[model samples]
Target: MGRMGDATRTVPCDAVAVSSIIETTGLVMEFPSTRALDGLDLRVSPGVTGLVGANGAGKTTLISLALGLLKPTSGGISVLGLDPSADGPQLRAMIGYGPERNVFPDDMVAYDYVRHFAQIRGLPRDEARSRASDSLYLVGLGEERFRALGTMSTGQRQRVKLAQAIAADPRLIVLDEPTDGLDPVQRDEMLAIIVDVNRKFGIDVMLSSHVLEEVERICDNVIALDAGRLVAQGSLDELAGALGGVDVEIVEVADRRDSIDLVAQRLVAGGWTVARRDPGLTVTGENDEEVFDAVVRAVADSGARIGRLGRRRRTLDDVFTNERGDSSDRPSTARTGGTE
Candidate 1:
């Protein structure tokens, strides 16, 4: 559930023996007037990684380039240390992909779809079918493995895609929005399966999603993208620690919303800036002792009973939005790009 990447080690060349699951440098992508990826750099270790970003934040582009589905206009790219452009077949064969986009044959059964990819990855017909069944079982879709793709629920179909990706026993698996369209229970189940695959089966994973909570809950490492560029890359703690400010939540008694203004006055008089406090709750600028004392005194004086007070940690969204806002504030002409 924490970040898993470390940049201290160098990438090896032979994929068959490659220790680094994925690596890219100065990776770039173009789309008419827009650049989808700019001088991006990325590295992934042998565990679950969260590729966190928005839909158009070059997340798809990064995956495509990394998977050898799209060629980079410039810079180096490799998955399992194999050049995706020149060694696509081998690279793909070593890696499994569950695309974010829906591009399935609606008429086919889940089993058939998975079996086809497994066979393509060079398994014999019987072996492919067997592995296909096994993969579907792993994703919790065993009962619907032979169900027509169009008839299954979105969650079921999502698992079908996952099964196909993992059917070949590849060393690495990439899941794009694996939890999309799933209920919380379904999401938890799917995540458990993914964790089992990574921890129990020893397969590395690269997961892409815009959901910060989901990523924060499951990923071992994170590579965050924003506005078609790398904004930050590291563990959750590292990024959260980079914050100069802190988050604090203050709670009060019932029907005491108007007490907020008085509370604010007390906090200000005590030298603390209250970020927000409408009624029963307040967010302070920081979580230091000075801020805490001021908030406590303010709540006590407001005559509103205190329910709870706690320090709030910085979330992934906060870090990314701040950096992206700064980037957007800069003059366009002054911008320089890079990739990950």
Candidate 2:
């Protein structure tokens, strides 16, 4: 099989115009037992966007609404300038979807499965066959294209799902938990393919995943949801800002504890918040320039050799934790109702 990234064959698909790939206002979805979405507003542009949330945070419901599978309880949504409810068929024709579940038929070969979907998407029989072959090779399944899906591993099955999604050459692709059941190496491969799909084909992508680190790795923008509400939406750099502090690592010394204590005392006197960490200290102040000066003064006053000093970059996890106001180390699993 050809490496996914090495495939130079271009599939036939038109690039979408630059516009709001997805936009929604006051969108809500209510179930019999509870509300899944609550007055959510989102304006996502064309690119790779990460749809992030805890379980039951309306990520799945929102994707359904975008695809026109389910009508909303209130408000409006526009995908590719077409209303999903009014133009469901046309909208779906332009969008490719890879669902989270293993919904493949066990008896079908990979090529036949992808070709079937391509034909269903209105491709001619001959074009469907060609697209299927190219897509399978693009996903590193060229050698396995004739193998039955039931015989494939979980990672290989995921690649098959991706191949079928792109075989029709849709303008946009939406993936849910695409890397759910893969090992570290497999996960990396899948992520590279997703990125290549967008980079090479110009297909806009809305990736829904619970793994924040994976989202941070590839997504250009992030939409973070909490309990069916929009908690945060911005570029990764905008959301994960600098920690507003300097991390200091002190060189080992005979009186290490005493030196750390002295530095802490000096920083506190300088109106800086000092928190002790193993082998280091975290100092934060209102002004970055002043904070830097305070840190240098503290280290010098303590007569301690400085090992390292630098600002720390906040991660998506930190943003999610702070936004949710949940201090638990475990990832968020807050649910509203029904399957997420």
**RMSD each, Å:** 8.8, 7.3
Pairs of residues clashing in candidate 2: none
Q: Write the per-residue lDDT of candidate 1 for residues 1-340, one digit (tens) a residue.
A: 2234433332221237676777879988998888999998877766788887766888888888888778898989888878988878667767888986666888999999999999877677899999999999889888888889988887787788889888988888999888777777777777888888889887888898877777777777888887678877876566654333324344545677667677777776666655664334444555565566666677778876555665656667667757866533221211122111
Estimate candidate 2's RMSD in Å: 7.3
Task: Give the winner by TM-score.
Answer: 2
What local lDDT score does residue 186 receive in model 2, on the 0 to 100 scale? 81
In model 1, which range of ten residues has the least summed lDDT? Answer: 331-340
**Each model's lDDT:** 0.75, 0.85
TM-score, cand. 1: 0.79
Candidate 2 structure lDDT: 0.85
Model 2 weakest lDDT span, ten residues long = 331-340
Residue runs of model 1 more than 4 Å from their true location after superposition: 1-19, 241-248, 251-258, 261-302, 305-308, 326-340
User: Residue by residue across 214-272, what tens digits does model 2's lDDT show?
Assistant: 88888888898878998789787788768688888987578665888888899998788
